[model samples]
Every structure is written in C-alpha cells, then in structure tokens.
Target: MAAAQDPSLFLGFDFSTQQLKVVAMDESLSVVHQSNVHFDSDLPEFRTRGGVHVHADRLTVTSPVLMWVKALDMLLDKMKEAGFDFSRVKALSGSGQQHGSVFWTRGASETLKNLQPDQSLETLLQDSFSVPASPVWMDSSSRKQCDALQEAAGGALRLAHITGSTAYERFTGNQIAKVRATRPEEFQKTERISLVSSFAASLFLGGYAAIDYSDGSGMNLLDIRSRSWSQICLEAVSPQLDLLLGDPKPSSSILGPVSSYFVQRYGFSESCRVVAFTGDNPASLAGMRLQQGDIAVSSYCLPPNSREVKAVESDTVFLWIADPRPALQGHVFCNPVSEQAFMALLCFKNGSLTRERVRDQCAGASWEPFSAALRDTPLGNGGNIGFYFDSQEITPPAVGVHLFDPQDVQVCSFSPQVEVRSLVEGQFLSRRLHAERLGYSIIPGTRVLATGGASSNNEILQVLSDVFNAPVFTLDVSNSACLGSAYRALHGLSAESGASFFDVVKNAPEPQLVAAPHPEAKEVYDQMLQRYARLEERVLQKSRP
Candidate 1:
C-alpha cells in the first residue's frame, strides 16, 4: 500500500510537441523530481526536426508514433537512473499535445500487457503501429475533406453550431476523412483511434484507452452542447465511426491499476492508479484553477484564448440536440475538474513567432533593445497602427504586414521605434477585439492570468495589462500543464481520502501581480483599437477574390 503522508508521490507527464516532460509531486503538491526527454535533442535516432516531419507541401505535418513509445521507454529508464523510487508513487496522470493521434495494430494491446520484465518496451513494441506516421495539429492538408464534411452537415455555420467551431483542416475529423479517401486499406486494418492524450494513458492501462471528453472536443466530433459524439458528424466523416473511435470518458476517471509492464519492469507499485489523461489546454485550465469569468491568456508556442463557461443543467444523460445559436470560432471543451462547466479556446497561428520576427528586423534580434523600444515610445504610436503576419493567421486569415497613420492613410516607411510599438500593440489589440466578439469582457475586477515563457517579459505583460485594462498575473511555476496534471492525479486519488481538488492545492504558491493597467495607456489603446478595425477591413477588402 502507498503511504498517506511524506513518502506518497504522484507522477504527472506532459507529452508536448517538442519534448516529453514529467513531474513528481509529493502529498503537499510540491515538486520532488522533474525530468524531460526532448524529442529532437534526446531522440536523434528519429531524425526529426522539432519533433515533426514537415512535408514539402508545408500543409502536411506528421510525427513517428513509435518515436513517442520510444520516448516513454527512455523517460522511465532515465527516471530510474536518477535514483527515484517508483514504489512511492500513488497515482499517475498525463497531458498531451491536443488533437494529435496514434494508431495501434491488432495485437498491440496484448503486446503491451504481456511485456517482458527483462527487456525494454521499445524493443517489444517496435512493430505495434499500423499507421507509422500520425498527423498532428500542424497539418492543414485536409482542406478538401473539411469542405466536404462541412457541406455534408449543411454548411459551415451549421457545422460550427454542431461541433463548436467551423470545419478546420487541422481537426482530426478532417484528417481521418483524408486517410479514408486515400488509404482505404489502412483505415480497414485499423482497430481503434486514440487521441495523443489517451494513447499515453493506454500505455499504463495495458489496453486501448478511451478518449477523454476534454481532449475529444478538439477532434470536431464531439457535440459541444451534448458532450457526446455526434452521429450526424460521424456519418458525415466516415462509416462506423463509433467503432473506430471508442467511447470517451470524463478526464478525471481513474482507469485500473498500473500495467504489469511497469509493475514488473520499473518496480512501480501495483496499487498505483492511472488517472485519465487530458489535453494540455484543459490541464492548464485545471492547473490555473480558472473560475467562470477568468481568462487564461497563454503566450506559449501558440497563443490560445481559453475561457471557462457555464452550461445549463439537463435531465438527460446525453443531450444530442445541437446548439441553436451561432457558435464561437473557438473550441468548447469540458472542464477537467468541473463537469458542469466547459472551456472555449481560440488559437492564433501567428503568435510570439510573429513578434519575434519584427523584433529581429527592427531591434537587432535582442529583447533588451525591443524592451527599451517599448518603454521609450508612447502608447498607440501616435495613431500609427500595423498588422504583422509572418505566417498564416487564424482570426483574420491574412498574411503580410500593413501599416497606417493617424489619418488612416497607408505608411510605407517608419522608424524602428514606431515598428516595435506597433507590433506589440497590434497583437494585443487583435486579441482584445476577437475576445470581446466571443463574449469575454474587460470589466473591473477582471483578472488576466498570463502564462508561458514569454509572459516573463515585463514589456509584453505591460502591454497585455494596458490593452486589457486589467491586472495581469504570472504563476511562479513555468509548466502549468504538468503541474495541473500532477494536481489531477492527487485530485482523483483524494476522493477516497476526503480532500477535494481545491483542498489539497489551495496552498500551492499564489500567482504574483506582475503588471497593472495604466489609465493613460488604456485611453490610447482604446482609440488605436478602432483604427485597427478599419485598417483590417481595408486590407481584407484588398485581398478578397
């Protein structure tokens, strides 16, 4: 039996795009030992750049499914090497990069359950994958399938109303449709489809793991209002979709004990329970402990707008009725902790990367110069606004830079100071505009939780605060997803021990107040936002077919 106090530890894993990170926390929720296996640096055998194989088409992005399995094998062995005892761990859970998938062969489950204690997992399951390469979220080659599925469901608006977002090529539903159309035989041989989150969960469960409700929302298959798979969407995508995609369960549902593979191989206690893993965003939500009105503004690899929303109570177990109102452009996912609430997220393809591009061009590629530029220049750049899209953007769906002056006339030339301020102000202004359109408000007492690596920059956080006109706070810990998963492990196990999720993690270090909005800066940004709207309209008009 696991100890109740000092020795009790919970293990949480976060399998992200570039690396697989694990954190071990004690009963008090303090991190004990943390480690990671970076895919590009650690697994040189895969020969992958940034953990993915980007095709020449630039629209097709994939990763080796076996690379992830191999990563798990190495991660555990590395943990054992660090003198950590697996026996002290009471429970385990994980978070994965949302929407990526993995396919298993016919005998893969048996292979997983019946692993040899003497040998490693990679050697045992080398041939376990039926589809060697899995399409990830960066993939956008399924435009043809997205259009067809949208048409099959009546239209884009109707489809968004049903699935919580308009049909996007990156969604798993469209990717699966592309596979069925091009490679029918591979789809036939496939027995099950698992999201990246559940695939990591299955490794510990010793069989096929069911997708969790929170992660399933990204696949564009779950009925946002009903919280179940939509039959119309299933038929619209492919036949027997239900069979291929197993039933999804709540994110906190604990599966069985640790797999015999781990118990025998790594000396993991047989009593260690495996909590259902979820997507990184939902894990972050749980980690941040966001309430009904709070917003999680992440500046991670991608900028994702995560807002917690309340759902109406229903008598039926599953409501198949579609939401009659027009749906927001972002995704709606079930809250991992609270079943009664859900989260809506909007991801912008051009995030910090776009800002970094402008910084490199205008500020000599150093953040010190960029920070100085922000501090020296006045807010709104004297009514000079710019839109910088170094890559394809989601909200406006346009690329290339456009700059304007106070009189709404185009400006082709500007100094580095003007360029630097415009980039920062423009990015946040666009976010504020889209956020309000999706029902988020910047009223008094509204707290914006800023996270991710870029959040540490005071210049960036200051802009976030001034534009949103709310106090911006940053967490002490950097990896919110892993920390959240660690909390989930404890939260699931505490059910029998009588401590709720909040009861256990309430004392975990509080977020520091990093930046507060300035009334003077707020006034300038409000006027600049109006100019941004008009400039965006003129640019979109010029780009129209």
Candidate 2:
C-alpha cells in the first residue's frame, strides 16, 4: 500500500563497523538514491606514561568517528555529482555500529560554529582531534574496568540485572571507566560522551547531545527498564554525570535541524530533519520487519559469555533478572541472546577475509573458483580438514584469542586447504551448539537468517546450511544496517499517527530471497560437529594463560 500522501525523501547514513553507506529513499521505501564510501581512523590510546617508570608498551585502539565524517563528505560529493537535488530531501537519520562512543568537548561548539559550508575535510581533520576519536565498540582493553564495575555492583548478575547486558569489554561504560582510570587528565577534559549514532546525528544537526535507547542498551549504563540512566549504575561508576554522558532519548525523537553551514556546504536541503540514531543490529532487525516471532540473525562472530551455566536439577531458578519491562510492550521472553524467537546467529569475525587470504596464497584462486571448489568438497569437508573461524564465540568452549597451533605458536600449517576448511567448519559447529544450548532444537527443519559480509558468499552460506542442518535465508540488501535504518525512519513517520511497530513493518518491503538447506549433507555435519567440540576443548586447555 502507498502512503496516505507522497512521502518525503529521506537520506540515511549508516556509520558501520567497516564503512559508511548513504541511501535516499522515498515514502515507498524505494531506493531512489544511494552511495557508499570506505574509510578508517586511528584507535584510542590505552595508557600514557611520562615518568622514568613508564611502560613502553601501550595499547592503542582506533575509533570510527573520523572515518564516518570523511565518508559522509565523500557521499555528499557523490550525491551532488549524480545531480540529485538537495532541496527534495526532507529527513535525515542514521544507523551506526552499536556501543562505540564519541567524546565531544565543550570546545567542539566553537569549531562547529566556525565550520564554513565549503570547508574542506583537510581543515576539519587538522582540528578533528579537538574531540578524542570515538571509542569503537570492538575494543576489548576495558576488561579491568569491567571487573571493577562488577565488583562495585556486587556481582556480574547484579550488574546485568541493572543494565540489560553483563559487563563486556566493548560496552561504553567500561570504556569510559578505562579512560577515567588510565588517563584522568583526559577524562577531566572530556565534556560529554555520545554514542557514534548520536554523535553523527549531532554533527548534521549542528551540535547536540542525546542518545537513543537501542544504542543506549549497548552502553551498560542505561537502565533498560526505566529507559534512562540508572542511578545505581552511575553511583557505582562514580562518573561526573554532566561531562561523561548525555541525556537519553527515544529512537524516533527529532534532535534538531541540519546546520545551515552543512546545508550550504553539502548542498542539502534546509528542510532536512535530523532524527535520533540507533545501533546497526537493532536497525537491521527493524529493517527486516521482524515481528513478534520473527528471528533476526547475524553471521558476525560474538564473544562467548563466560557466565552462562548449564541447566541444573532445579527446573525454575528464581534469579532477580533485569526487568526488561520498560522496553517490552507486550509479554515476551527476553534473554541474553536476541529477543526474537529462534534467533540462530552464527558469526565468524575472521571468516570472509581469512578465507580470501587463504585462497589467494595457497590455491592462487579467485572467490568464485574457491567457492566452486568448496561445493565439490564433501560434507564435514570430507573429514580432511577442520577450519576454525575466530570471529566471536558466545557459548560453551569459548575461545577469544586466536589459536592456530596445537604445539608451537610459530609452527606453520602443512596443508593450507585443510586449514581453511577447519576455520569454516569450526564456526559452523560453534553456532549449531550455541543455538542448541539456548533451548533451540538443531534439526533439518530449522530456518536461519544469514547476514553480514560473509552472508553474501554462497559457499559460506551453503557450508553453514550443511553444517547446521538448517535452511539459511539471505537478505537482498547488501547493507542490512542501512536498510534497517530506513525501516526505523519509516516507523518514526508512521508512529506520528500512533501506529503499532509491527503494523509499520508488515507494510514494509519484503526480503529478496530465501535459501534452503541441502538434505544430503545433514548427517555428515552432525558427526563432524561432535569432533569439532572435542578439538575445541583440547585447544582451549592448551591456549589458556
């Protein structure tokens, strides 16, 4: 169905983990315009020492903020070159990788005011350090802070009960605490911290500070039930509230208008409205039009939860769970995993790039040829190899550090082809067991949605399908986050009329295609999965510090 009136054009900027994607869509959700740009920025510094006793080895992690800004500039240039009129664009919203944050000093206000419409990025970059680079969500140097917070809050479960998530290395609170503990000077200098999503939105809207709940949930600071900052958590962190964080906002709230300087410089319409930003995963879920029972899965690897316990003799354990009631609309079972039913996510962080590298070095083969070779290979890769993809491990036999050796760390693999297959099968078996432990039955009939960069590869998808004994669904949208952002924007518009979130998604566009499992490969995969578990257990025991 068409919108009641002709829907205005919206430009969605997705600040993702690897790149920035910009899309222009009308009310019908048709991609009337689009542009993508790739970029990277330096990581943050973990420690600074000036005295004689100072340690020479310091940990530094890069943030994606500068990359985002540069990409946005490039996208605008491309849009202008394409001859898309800036005046027709009516709204602006963004989707960014969740949890990562940008710390903006009060000094940013002055630089933001002086920004000319035609100012070059070089000029901006020269002053870009005015605010420290955004702390990316993937940085894991905050373990000390995470442990401290858990101790301060009483326990891990208590902290998780306060925040929706347990203490993670990537969560914003731990990152902020790390800054405070390591570099008190910089922490004092920081004026306000905003998640990447909100920070990008603030830039377009001139300058503002407000976070969306979906992104806030990833911070481990927001009280999910209250949809606001948790006093208990704040007291535990002892953060200078005014400078360290911003007021939280709903996902759809209009933060402000695009600055006149940006309008004149980027040639964007003055009528553009800046909406709140959300995490990429949450955006993808919204974009897929996921319903009450619809599951949203990602192929990206996740860190394993060390706190997970196997079910015991007691059928019902009365644990004080974090009441997700504030965020819940209706009665629904919510867990550490995705809230959607039967969410079978299988992530391989080092999956695609590693596979490409392997093919390049060993076989001197292209992606298509290598994938075709994989097809010829039998289930469980003919029992000739066991490939372990170390993207993210979430359940039993969790292995975070990369381990490619059983004996010497420097020993080289004798067979490159066998090594490659081992990595792939490792990820497949890990996902299967993870889902099963979560109370999901891993059978031939289970349907799984495969997304992320790895999802685009038919070989990877097929291998996953065979290994898991389930049908793998691939989405048409190359960037699920951007599409999800658009879905959220449409929902925001529809929400003005007080429409249900499900109703809005139901009226949205349908997915591109659905890939089913291969029946012949199921039994072989089941046997191989058991072998993978044993290998993983032995490997982890040897690798521990």
Candidate 3:
C-alpha cells in the first residue's frame, strides 16, 4: 500500500518493562520518527533496578505507576522538542508489557477527563492509582491464587482449554486476587483496573481504555472461545469484575480520540484516534506481518481473508526482541486476527541478562568476544549442557546455575567459550522444546520473527536456527513490539471497513534471512533436546521446596 491517501501518520507506542518507546509511520509504512524513555537511567528517582522493585520475597516484583506516568511525560515532551507534528498523526495504537496491572483510584475517570493542559500527567494524576506500585509480569507470588483458580476451574488442562493458558502467577487475574485477599483496602479503592497496555491507552484516551482481547487473554479471566470474561474465573477472584474491567475491545477497535490534555498541551489534533492497545506479544505478531499456521495477521492466527487456506507459509522474515525474557506469541494465545484461530506464545524469564552475565564473566562483557566464543566452541559444547538463571525461571521454575557433562554427571562449570555456547544453546533448546509440547513444530519452512536486545546477536540467533532446525530471519529494527504497534495503528483505520490486517501491512519491508540451520542441525538438536529435558526435569525436582 502506498502512503494512505492523505499521507497521514500513525503513531505506535510500547510501554515496556524498562522504558516507553514510540514509532511514527507514514502511510507508506515507513518509520518517520522514533524515540524512547529509559526508566532506570532517565527517571532515576524511581530507584528501580531494571525498572522494577523486587520485594524482599524476590518473587513479588512491581513497578511504580508514577514512574510509568512520568516516563510518558518525558517521552512526549522529547517528541515535541524535536518539532514532530503531532497534528498530522491520524491514529495511534500501542503495545504494553504483558500482564502488568494498574489500579485506578475511585473517581480517577473524572480526574482523567478534566485534566489541566498546563499540568504534567505525573503531577495532576499523582494520586490516580489505588496502588502506587503495580504488580508486573515478573511477579510469581500469586501461586496461591493460581492454584485456587485452577482447582476452581476443575484442573490445569481444563483451565488451559478455557483460557488458552493454565494459571500463571504473572497473569492479571491472580495478581488481582492477591490484592483483593491481602489488601482489601486497596481493592475497595480501585474503581477501574487496566493492564499496562490499556492503562497507557487510558492516559491518551483521557478515560479508561477497554482492555483488548489479545492482551486480555493473558489475564486468565477472558474466555478464549467467547472472547469475553469468564464469570467463573472472575467470581473466583472478586465480585463484579465487569464493572471494574470494562468490556474488552478488539485489538483493532478505535477506542476514541486522544485526550484534551494532549490536544491543548502538546498540539495533538482533536480528531486523532486512539486505537485499542494490546499486549506486546500480539503486537509483535502484527508487526511481523505473521499469517495463519505459518504467520498471522494476529498472533498465531490468519486474518479473515486468509483463514480458508488452513495453513500458510511466510517469507521467513525476521524481527527482534529487546527484553531478556520476551513474551513471544506462541502456543494458542488468543489470536487477534480471527476468533476461530488462536495465537501461540512462549515466555522465558532468564534470557538476555542471563546470557549477558555469562558473557561478562567469559568474554569481558563484549559481544565480539562472545560471538567468537560461540563460534569457537564445538556444537553441543561436547555434550555439556548448562542451565544458568540469575533469578527464578518461569518455564521450569528453576533457579541458580546447573552444569552437566556428556555422561549426565553434574559438573562444576566449563571454560569461558563453552560456557557462552551452553547458555545460548540452552535458551533456544528450551524454546523449541516448549513449542513442540504446544503442538507447534519446525516445518520445512518455519521462520522465526523477533526483535530485542539479544536478537541483535547473530551468534545467538545461529543457535536459535540450529536448535529449531529452521532458518532465522531479521528486520532492521530491534523492537518488534513498537513496529507491531505502528502496524496496528494503520490496520485499525481499515478495521471497520473490513480490511484484513495482512492487507494493511503486507507492503512493509520483508525480513532478511540472517541464518539457516546447518546440515546437521536437526539431528544434533533432536538428541540434545531429550537430554536437556531430562536435566531440566532433574532441576525442577530439586527446586521444589
């Protein structure tokens, strides 16, 4: 598609774990302006490590709501300082870090609507939240609630069948349940609850933004089949959640126009639409221009235009992942493209940071040496596998570093080069293993799309290709969530007109195939996966309290 008829701009924002990022694209789907706000370094007063406060319990992690608010304040000001024309932005959409919850104080909606153009968001809305710090996706302290939900729903598989996922501690429903149980006072004061995505949208919309179905599915509250809240699950957590959560909109629905605060304060056009924001994972799926079966207009799903084909093959293009443990679309999450097909997702806790730790120790904290080490080290590290996690891992719920030799005998460690290779291989191995368990596999033409800090490393991605035994592709940018949000912004305009998402984004640049699996990759990884699984099982057994 050529730049839209009017040559207007679509703005996409990503309220992520550590920062707030924005990308502006013209109708040509070309990025025209981009910027970001780093939480810890830029907003130092938050005093957050990696933008989160890890409670003494370690498993309970939260981020300051005011910090996120302030970051946005700074981000837009930076954009305005650069003389970007906000008035030309016809529509805007965004993706947020998945599952983080923001609590709105009673009457916050009215406070949002009547905001003063002169005041900063952080200043006027300082007391808008019931909880100053919101529970983030990193939290695992909601196990009690998870168990209760699963038991109440009958079992893990049943819950998974209903909600597209088993009860996960980081899920919003469990987090809300935890708050309701332990902090009844806070729960009582909360009038509206928003996921990080919708909350960010609420800031722009000047009212509560309805949670979109794509992100809503991650909460363990929305029914994957009906695309609405499960009454049983909601009642399990708290009473009358519908009033608090509002009705979730489609990922492509235009929520409303940007708030008066922006129009008067920062020169936004009154007519600029704010499309429904969604989870980062689904946004990335859209950004990657994924089609169904192979790729999807939404996460793991095909758009209505392409659904009849049953299976599709993509160009095997690339995207990036910046987070250490990115929540990737895989394994039957709700696909925003069509209700008939579900999206797939996989998340890992100890990704980039864990590898960076090993890189620091072995390769002088430099990627050049790190890449050389991976290249120099023999494949499979000579049958030496290592599991290195700085903190608790979500996948198998394991912690600490465990090393093993070819004989399955536990080892203390490896040389620097071997250690680097082990860490990279282990991460990708786990991704493939978990993906297969979800009934997805590496077909002949499987192509992985990702963008992130770690995705920049060709050596790391080579292992990803080898382990998955498929080719890996790459995009120019490192943040797929941001690009995907930008893509969704454009798609939302045609949504009411009934255009499939693929039609809107298909003309965007294609992914570059950075690496293909070596001839022996499939055979090598096949045997290695079983051993890694067994070792992981051993670690999980030991991790049990």
Best by TM-score: 1
- Deviation of model 1 at 514, angstroms: 1.8
Please name the candidate that would achieve the greatest lDDT relative to the true structure: 3
- Cα miss at 70, model 3 (Å)? 3.8
| lDDT, each prediction | 0.79, 0.59, 0.81
Worst 10 residues of 2 by lDDT: 311-320
Residue 85 local lDDT, model 3 = 91
User: Which parts of model 2 have CA positions greater than 4 angstroms off?
Assistant: 1-7, 17-19, 40-58, 64-74, 107-130, 240-244, 256-271, 288-347, 350-426, 436-446, 452-470, 500-502, 505-509, 512-514, 517-545
lDDT of 1 by residue, 352-469 (tens): 6777778899999999999999899886778888888765566677777888888888889679989988888888887776665555556556777877656779988898788878
* TM-score to native of every candidate shown: 0.87, 0.68, 0.79
Lowest-scoring 10 consecutive residues by lDDT in candidate 1? 312-321
In model 3, how large is the Cα lDDT of residue 284? 74
Please rank every candidate by TM-score, starting with the best.
1, 3, 2
- Global fold similarity of model 2 (TM-score): 0.68
lDDT by residue (99-193, candidate 2, tens digit) is 67776655776676567776754355344443455566546678888888778767876666666556877788888777777777766666668
Write model 3 residue lDDT over 356-397, tens digit each, in one string.
678899999899999999888777779999887677776657
In model 3, where do residues sit more than 4 Å from their true spots? 1-6, 40-49, 54-60, 116-119, 293-332, 336-340, 349-392, 398-427, 450-460, 519-545
